[model samples]
Target: MATFDARQMQSLTGLQATARTFLMVGFTVVETVALGLWLALVQGAPVISRPAAIGLGVLTVGLVVEHVLTDATVNGLSFSFPLARIVGISVSEALLWAVWLGIADRLGGVDGILVAGAVLSVLLVPQHSVEDNILRGEAPLSNVVNLNTIGFSLVEGIGATVWLLLVFEGQQFAGLLATLGFGGVDPAAVGLAALGIFLLVEHDIGVTLARQG
Candidate 1:
């Protein structure tokens, strides 16, 4: 009989980590875009909602800021560039959040947004767990319920909630806009500002944790 040694186990772990990363990146891109398209069809929009488009643009800027601040790089990339990580992660995150917001809007307006935020927070647990495990080269299910996961869930929930609130209630600022001789604040603009702040904070925390690990 033959058995694996420590070196062999380590090598296997590395291979698993690389495979998981590639799969996750690919799946995220596909799923996010698919979801956006589905939401567009449901909402009768040409492609995506105005708020979603604004959110994506703001998210891109936020990701660029995060990359500049952390100088973080995703591991196991065959080809690396100054903006590769930013572009990949930004597209995934932005599209996911855009479609998520669209769904929340349809669920029940303001109430639905809150519900969706909570749901997304819960879902992020497993997603973050997988990413964390990959970084440490640990087994897929190892230490899934951890402090970092919980913290990220909380952050995501709060961010999503605030973003949706601002977007939905953008009309609340109409009086202020009137004073400025403007028609009103567009919901898209409000969403952009709200999501930009949230993404910046969330990405900073995520990068810090990865660096610590």
Candidate 2:
């Protein structure tokens, strides 16, 4: 077996890296367009015609395909840098949020943007804390999904699900929250959920970080 120098290894992986970058770009575009179209229809925009809706559906399918392909490719290729892997995930998540906000903008505008931002900010806190530890070498990257990661995933998933439901079907769920007397979008609910999640996982890294100082 031949040994690869740093330059040689980079050259060999260059094509795969380029393909991954292009895939991410294509996925972002498709997600943005599909989400925008779906939200438009949900909001009764009258902007999406029949053919446009069909095209959006196709693009959404492509998004799913891209997600699977991205995971497969990344895991299949032996990447050298842990930081690179983390950064790639971070960029992908940022792109996802960008597309989400694009859809929210179509659905509601500035209010939608603010609500989405707040929701994402709160939801990502615990996960970010764990990730911060991992990136800083305080936590082992090989043990990425420990109790903290698992807890973060659960909280994030639950909070995000609630937020999405409110954004897409707030009117329907208004009856459920009738006792709260807030009939429309409730940013407060999402904020509270996020806060609870943050507190739940705070011990994982927050206490540790505090004690270190």
Candidate 2 versus the native: TM-score? 0.35
lDDT of each: 0.55, 0.47
Lowest lDDT 10-mer window, candidate 1? 66-75
**Number of the top-ranking candidate, with TM-score as the measure:** 1
TM for every model, in the order presented, reads 0.51, 0.35
Q: Write the per-residue lDDT of candidate 2 for residues 38-83, one digit (tens) a residue.
A: 4444344333467445544554454454334333333433433354
Relative to the unseen true structure, what is the C-alpha lDDT of residue 146 in candidate 1, on a scale of 0 to 100?
Answer: 58
Once superposed on the true structure, which residue ranges of model 1 sit more than 4 Å away at CA?
1-71, 74-99, 173-184
For candidate 2, give the lDDT. Answer: 0.47
Which candidate gets the maximum lDDT versus the true structure? 1
**Candidate 1 TM-score, C-alpha based:** 0.51
